[model samples]
Target: MRSSRRWRRLCGGRNSMDHTKQLLRISDIAAAAPDVLRYRFTAAEGELAPFLPGQYICLYYEIDGTTTGRPYSIASSPREAEEGGYYDLFIHVGGSFTSRWLGQHGTVGTTIRASHPLGEFCITPETPRKIVGISGGMSVTPLRSMVRSIVDSDTDREISLFCGWDDPAAMLFREEFTALARGCDRVRVRFALAQNPQPEDKHGYFTAEDILRETDAAEAAYYLCGPQAMYDTLHDGLTAGGVRPERYRREVPGELHCPPYPTAPGECYPLTIHTGSGTVTATAAAGESVLVALERAGVSPRAYCRSGSCGYCRSRLLSGEVWTDPDRAPATADGVFHPCCSFPRSALTVVLPE
Candidate 1:
């Protein structure tokens, strides 16, 4: 664990204060759960820009001369962001980014570049007066932001949070949420434990029936965040129970488990890439994504939501074969491909639009 101050100082003199992105200092870091760390970040200079409570910010790092980025949800309230120009992020320590940098080389003075807040998960004036949130594991981060914002703003809106965890030890912000719920009559919190439930806790997962019984289900907007199985179960159940699709939204987790694609072991093929500058060649492994190969060769193509849901990294497939999940692929008449999710099946030549 060393501070990233040296790198930040080196780059801070450049256009580090660009409007779209800025450097943030790690003001504090604490363990929120056995496997999660809560990091508090503040602007390195001036004040951080305003953002909605449920929005996310993308963090970038230059690792071994290659650029990498990841988006994390803000868990702190909008009020806190306004007052101190700071926000909190709950990161799972097991991830490669956290293990390699935040957990190993991060310190209170460490500085990193972060994008302006960007996401559509926040509430708006057009939203319903009541919000019902369902979350599991680290997915609770954004929901926590909503709760804190509502409480801090003293808004008339109501919120009911239904959170599930393996046990008490894995629950995040338990004490803080308890205090908030106790002090604010507009807030209601419920916990469900899959194992070793306390007397006050629900014995198992919360079903649509469970949530509907506790809230004005017809009038409340639903926000869900969790694993794919949990989301599928609750989404189907809620929709079947008469909740309209327009009345609910879900956030994609950082790591998605896509179905296994065919792999060519011990084989690497030549990949020709055409950019505005000129044409270049790189080595692409059969099982690795085109984006991975590009980044390995120090090529940066605009990308966000690497799960294929976002089309930011879309490129032209001049000539090649790629395997991708049909459900996640965007329908296009032309040979447009998502480099982030598409794995090369044969030698490929692709065009990256400038």
Candidate 2:
């Protein structure tokens, strides 16, 4: 491990955060797709920390004086992390501020703040079983980590991966995934092309029917990471096919894009939020997420992975009615909910964590 003094030197003598936050420098960048880039980062002066195969790191960026963070899945296996002293993140050029900033400034030697790995979507080595991974578009980043880990560790566990993209040019990590399949007998890789597929690819979107046809659906531990529509289709199809819920897990890449609430158009509701410091009130426009409402009122709340997969924005729904994206809604217990994916349906009150 590198010393803190070295880290400070590499980071221009900046003070380190007490927690897992680190200042890292981009070491390399490679085009993964037409709109996707693979960014490799290393500790300014020390070895990078190890992370689970399916975990993610939050990257913080300051744009127009507003600091915001976005979570990107770790695309490298744990073994690679230990050996290379770096982390790999595959980012798509989306409409988000962070993605736009990265597209412009993600050059080698650019220093940025990043959180340590955080997420629970990983394989438990002790509970080994046949594994099936399903992913779509850039969401394949974490699944690639899981699959690579399995191959690097020389685990005999049967692994089946189904990855889909809009087309061959849109597919990220195409060569790498194909190489892994060729090297490992227990690993099976399939590609789904949604449009203008080449002769070697499977046409159409990735569906539950593909999983059922390629792998042992009943016995394998299924891991899914993709768009919400994919989740809904797979969840319904798998359940109807008699697969137990416990045998499957899922992770959505970003905040849910829910349809407009059935309220009259242009309607807005009052939203009162009570935090440890004081109470803040704001108006939540129809079809807008409560998180956006809070931001609009200049209320700064700690949040990451705005897609609702991360529990960082969880708060207590003290009063009022809110509708959550069904696919991204966290399990509600004792009135707890993730406001990032919640839409106010009525005048609402919520208690924010300190």
Candidate 3:
């Protein structure tokens, strides 16, 4: 009763926050791919926040006492967000977080922190552009939720999903998508394979000519969801193939910036951080992001996605200034910033974005 009272008090009051803000637990984790696991997390009861149909969530994970976060599009529909149902997360069971998920020997009730769903990926309730999905491998994650939501609503639009995989095993949602396409009258599904296959086989790599042969890009809204190399290859090809820049929507592997931004060696500087709650200052070396310096300094300010993507490690530029490689800092009107990849040019002053 005492512990529950504390939990209730901490989440209730003026400026009160809810358990919705804490680390949720992994209620169940299942295997989907040889290298991928589908995680179903249970937030505190009655603590699930309402989310949109096409939004993504930032997941906070702790491995070997180290901190990090990655944002993933919710694979479940908004309808599932209510009624204390489950939210689905898919991760290739490798690397740090993947290793932990696979190694934990954990099961029901294992805890994990999941922030409120955040992202702008969504399909409109009314906008009807010929929907074209160019998916590669696990790129079907987000689109599956979209297909479910769209079909459940029974909207009037054509959804043509073009999926490319090396083999049947590489496919993400083969049976689920096939089932949806079978039932929906307005949905047309197409399959493409890159590997040499049986005599009766699908095409490969979703080339420009293949895209043109399949669907006229002139009046279509295209969504490309896949890895970095794949996104780059298809984006350039589709553009050259006459797909309007506006009509193409691709999901960025948000935190994972390829070829890590070039930071000149031996160009380090000092950093000062001030929070309304407290302040800590340190010297940051070049070739390292402010987030790294803070973490090394034992300043456990919240953070996620080392790239300036998820906006979780957002701090404020209180006095001194810093420089972002692309200068595309996600600073809101309140002056919050992504400390993850942000570097110091001169002596700098920053505070947690309130």
Candidate 4:
């Protein structure tokens, strides 16, 4: 593990919050799509620490005196981390923090706190030789990193990318991906447009035939990142096409909205929160997850992949009743649950980390 001193040096004039947290200064900002901005953070003094190509970092911010954070994929390649001491991120406008603060008040030289690179969404030693990457909208960020890293390393591994969007203009990294495919024989790229596809593009969403035509879906490793609907469609389509469930991994970008509670009590419950420092009382909404209720009461717990996949916001359900999806809940022997997916059903007492 490398020290975050490099990041701290880059964020000069800012104080480091802790060993795990580092400040990042935005070095450049440019338009990536219609409502998205590609932000670059440059290292001023030392080299930016290296991270796995598809891994992400939690960017934290203080809004109205309360701290909050969101996870975003590092769009730049590991080669950039070594040579340029910088990385890129795509932020869509009109969200909670990214939209509320960065999109509105952020600019070149703006600074913020962030966690060290984290996540297992990257290629591992056990990854198969052939890879098929499927993405839509801003979800293309991580795939971009993997593609760029593979190209930069001059690896012999084969990659096939299928990007989907509403139209040609809505597709991101089109020019870059086109050039990459034209230059590298190991890489192949395809685009699927829901409307008005060009001569060589496919129409509508990606189908099994579309994927099978490019590569052997059953033999290749699959990476998926996109919206819920897109993920469901592609996953089912690929599974039906002989792709094994264990051969594929997915990461859903942006906020993971919880499903509506069919039998919600429809009443708020008193909540007692116990942290390392002390205990605080708040109200947990029956309809919302405990994570949302905590945030609503001005308490921000470290969270990533709000879809309940990442166990960042794991808290002990000391004394309470919560309805959670056993499939999505984290596996733990302790009396703990991921607040992001667990909704309070009655008055509760919970314990959180400092």
Lowest lDDT 10-residue stretch of candidate 1: 1-10
List the candidate numbers ranked by TM-score, top first: 1, 4, 2, 3
For 1-354, candidate 4 gives per-residue lDDT tens digits of 122333233233222323266678899999887878888986544445557768887777677766667788999987687777788988786656546588888788888877777776777545687889999877899999988876876446778999998867667899999999999888899998888998888888887667877788768988988887887677777888888887888884555345455545557899999878788899987777788777766765788666577677888888978887665674565678888878877899988966
What lDDT does each candidate get?
0.77, 0.77, 0.64, 0.76
lDDT of 2 by residue, 48-119 (tens): 755667878888787666566778899987777777788888888665656978999778999998877776
Looking at candidate 3, the ten consecutive residues that score lowest on lDDT are: 10-19
Q: Which is better, 1 or 2, measured by lDDT? A: 1
Worst 10 residues of 2 by lDDT: 5-14
Give stretches of model 4 more than 4 Å off. Answer: 1-19, 44-47, 258-267, 286-288, 296-301, 325-327, 330-334
Global Cα lDDT for candidate 4: 0.76
Name the 10 consecutive residues with the lowest summed lDDT in model 4.
1-10
Local lDDT at 287 for model 4: 71
Better of 1 and 4 by TM-score: 1
- Across 1-354, the per-residue lDDT of candidate 1 in tens digits comes to 011232233234322333367789999999888767888999997787666667778787777887766778899976688776798998877776534476777789999988777666766555688999889877899999989877866457889999998777888977788899999999999989999888888998989889888877678889998887788778777887767777888886553323275465767788999988988999888766788788777775876566666566789989988876564566565789888777777899989978
- Winning model by TM-score: 1
List residue ranges in candidate 1 displaced over 4 A.
1-19, 97-99, 257-259, 262-266, 326-329
